[model samples]
Target: MGAPARKQRSGSRMGARLTVWASDHGRAAVGALGRLARSRVASIMTAGVLGIALALPAAFLLLLDNLERHAGDWDDGAQVSLFLQADVSPEDQAALAASLAERTSIRRTEVVSPDEALEEFQAVAGMDDALAFLDENPLPPLVIVYPVTGTPADEIEALTAEMGEHEAVDTARLDLEWVQRLQAIMELSRRAAWLVVILLAAAVIMVVGNTIRLAIENRREEIVVTKLIGGTNAFIRRPFLYEGAWYGIIGGVLATVLVEGGRLLLSGPLERLASLYQTGPLLTGLGLQGTLALWAAGIALGLCGSWLAVGRHLADIEPR
Candidate 1:
């Protein structure tokens, strides 16, 4: 009976301790918010700075996403053209096209006979009169192949090499050099984004740290009094941590608003431009995941900034 009574009392004590802890945190949160309310201009100014820092990187990242999507929409890396031997007749070319249609690697094939190729060159190159003197056609039969989507570059190159070895194929060419260049550009853009993020993150920490240091200075006398009255550092530190967290959360929200507003403002012009480029519309604003990540990043920066400030400055303030 005594053992069960002791167990019950232990459980009750645990529950009461948890309740007290929660109450303290709740009070701290309210106190922190109230402090911000008291100095609205300063809080807004700090948060605005953080928001702008976040928005710059976010905008560039969204632009890169749109460019990537536009490139992908054109199936830029999904085609290879085969120019057949001059001796391969139109009938043979037609038969080769039929055979290519059944191959898994080749999604679609179009056969351009020598005559049609010559006619196109005559029309586009303005060389019809010069070509009229020739007795035989100089252009060869061509087969334009559209590869299945998402086919690896290596596989496509291998297929091109194999097709070039065919007796009927004079040459197989895949104009993927441009695609490679685009991919390189995308890689560079990604690196730039990371660089921007790193610089902005440091800026955020510094901004929050400076703001927190000022707050600590403003309450120096109160801190000294608390120390004299035996208030533990943890107890004294709670409100400041909560205050920093509030700043971070608000800053993140402001950043989201700024980013989305910019996206909306640019949507009309970008959508029209995308139509001209014959790609899907430009990438949209930050989705749920991105918004949440922004908020999380902001909170982390605020906490770290506050922690650094408090650790350095709190040690210097004493009853004396």
Candidate 2:
């Protein structure tokens, strides 16, 4: 009975201590928020800087994503033109196209006879009088081959080379230079965006740390007095950590707002541009997942910055 009673008492004490700890944390968090509210202008200015920093990379990445999506739509137009030898018969050209169509890499093949090619050139070039002087059509029979969707650029190039080697084909031309250039630009933009993100993240940490350090300096006397009264470092540190967290949360929210606002502003112009190409909307904003990640990143940076400031500055403040 005595042992059981002792265990119960111990449990109660532990629960009481936990409740006190949680209450203290809650109070600290609320108090820190109140302090920020009291200094609206300064807090807003600091958070505004952070928001701009966070939004730049986020916006760049979002733009890159949208461009990549638009580029994918362009991929459907990528096709290889296989110009057959002049000597190849119509039957042979059709048979070659049929064989290429059956391959896994080739989606489908379209055959254009020499006469059709000449007629198309004449229609577009308006050179009927000049062509009438020629006894024979100059254009060879053509086979246009479209690769499977989502095929790699290298694979398409390889397929082009393979098709060019065929006996009936004079040359295989893949008109994908624009697509390749677009992909290269996308890769470069992605890397540049990441670089900007890293640099801005470092800037955010430094800004938060400096801000927290100034705060600690302003409260030097209070901290010293608390220490003299037997307050532990952890207890003194709680409110400052909360202050940093609040800064981060506000900054993250501001960043989201800025990004969305920018997206809305650009959406109209982007839609107009996409309409010229008969494509769908080209602008995509930071969705739910991205917004949450931005918030999480801000919070983490804030906590880290504040922890560093508190650990360094708080230790220097001692009861004298």
Candidate 3:
């Protein structure tokens, strides 16, 4: 009988231990969740602010990326137009094209006769009647040259200068304005992106900090009681840290949703704009990497904010 009783008592002890363990974990989880849910208004407000802050920078980044992609595809075929001298014959222009085509840097060359140039100008300028009234075509023949891929800019410029110095070539024009402007714009966008990221990060920190401060104020009595009952500072701080983490996680998710929603909203209009310009699809919004970074940032902000709050306020709240 004694042995059976002892076995029953041991089983009861095990069951009680299991129950207590389960209850503590459950309560802790509930406490963390409840704390977040209780501050619904504050949580939603903070999350919305974070979403807007993240969205602005993210939209700017997407635009910058698309612009860079378009710039990168700029026609690598550097154009060099050689205007023929007034006295240069059609045969002479043809010979020049053949000669330039033999150079390794020259991918292709073509000679446009004076009559063809006049017709092209007339069509483009919508002045066919004006051109017909003239006794003879005033436009000179042109030798247009295109360089192969990997042709250095300096080499192209030198080639243009050499062509312009020729007896039959009156002038040579190379359009390098596109490349210079694209490069400048890309640099400016890069700098602006960095600035946006910095400002957004500071905004996140402030949001988390304020949230943690409010949490501390709400839980002042709980913290005081815990300290009085021999609960370690770490144990008391654990739930607040968890609260911060929850804020970060929720904020990150909210931001992602906002970003994706904005992308969907703009996609149709963007596609239409691309079609009008005869361009391929343009990418927008945060990609997988960006999404992951946002999540990590939110979690880090939460942890840091909680740490700062507990470290500063907890020390001053010790029970006398």
Candidate 4:
């Protein structure tokens, strides 16, 4: 009976200690939030700065994503044209076109006979009078081949080279200079987005760090007193960490709002512009995954900033 009673007492003491710890941390977190509320204007202003800094890069990256999505519509998917050897029989041209059409990479193929080619040139160039002087039809049979979905410009060039090696193919041309240029521009945009994000992420860290430093200064006396009364550094650090977390989370929310808000504002005008060209695909806003990532980045940066600030300045106010 005595041993059981002793065990019960030990359990009660441990439970009591756990409760005390829970309340201490809870109170610290709440107190830190209350402090931010007290200085609402300054806190809001600092968060706004961080939000704008984070939003710029995020918006640019979003724009790049949208552009990449619409790259195919921007005339980058040019077709390949194959001309058969002049002496190649009509049966050979048809066979070649039929075989090329069977391949998955070739979206479709159209054969333009010599007579049709001559008629098109005559219509476009108004060269019927000039062509009357020729002894025979000089145009070779033509095979126009389009690329399948997701086929890139380089792959089309490679396909063209492979086609030219065929016995019946006189020449295979894939004039995708414009597509190549667009790909280059897209690559540059990707690099630029990363560069801007890196620069802006550093700015976010600085903004949060400075804000936390000011908060620490305001609580210098309280922190010193807590230390004098034998409060551990970890106990004192909890509020500041929570405070930084609040700032980061709130800033991230503000940044996401700014990005989506701008996207919303532009959607109408953008839709009208796309509609003018008869393209049905509309501008898109951030999806669920992207929105969550934005919030996560904001919170993480906030915690890091707070941790850095507390580590640097909290130790300096050593009850002196």
In Å, residue 232's CA in model 1 sits off its true spot by 2.7
Report lDDT (CA) for all predictions.
Answer: 0.87, 0.91, 0.80, 0.86
Candidate scoring better on TM-score of 1 and 3: 1
Whole-model lDDT for model 1 versus the true structure? 0.87
After TM-score superposition, the amount by which residue 143's alpha carbon in candidate 4 deviates from its true location, in angstroms, is 0.9
Give every collision pair in model 3: none
TM-score of 2: 0.92
Using alpha carbons, what is the TM-score of model 3?
A: 0.73
Global CA lDDT of candidate 2, please? Answer: 0.91
lDDT: the better of candidates 1 and 2: 2
Clashing pairs in 1: none
Count residue pairs with overlapping backbones in model 2: 0
Best by TM-score: 1
Write candidate 4's Cα lDDT for 112-224 as tens digits.
99999999999999978899999999999998888785687678889999988999888889868888888899999899889988888888888888889988898899899
Residue 169, model 3: lDDT of 81
Please say which candidate is ahead in TM-score: 3 or 4.
Answer: 4
Error of 3 at 38 (Å): 3.2
Clashing residue pairs, backbone N/CA/C < 3 A, model 4: none
- Number of clashing residue pairs in every model? 0, 0, 0, 0
Residue 17 displacement (Å), model 4: 6.5
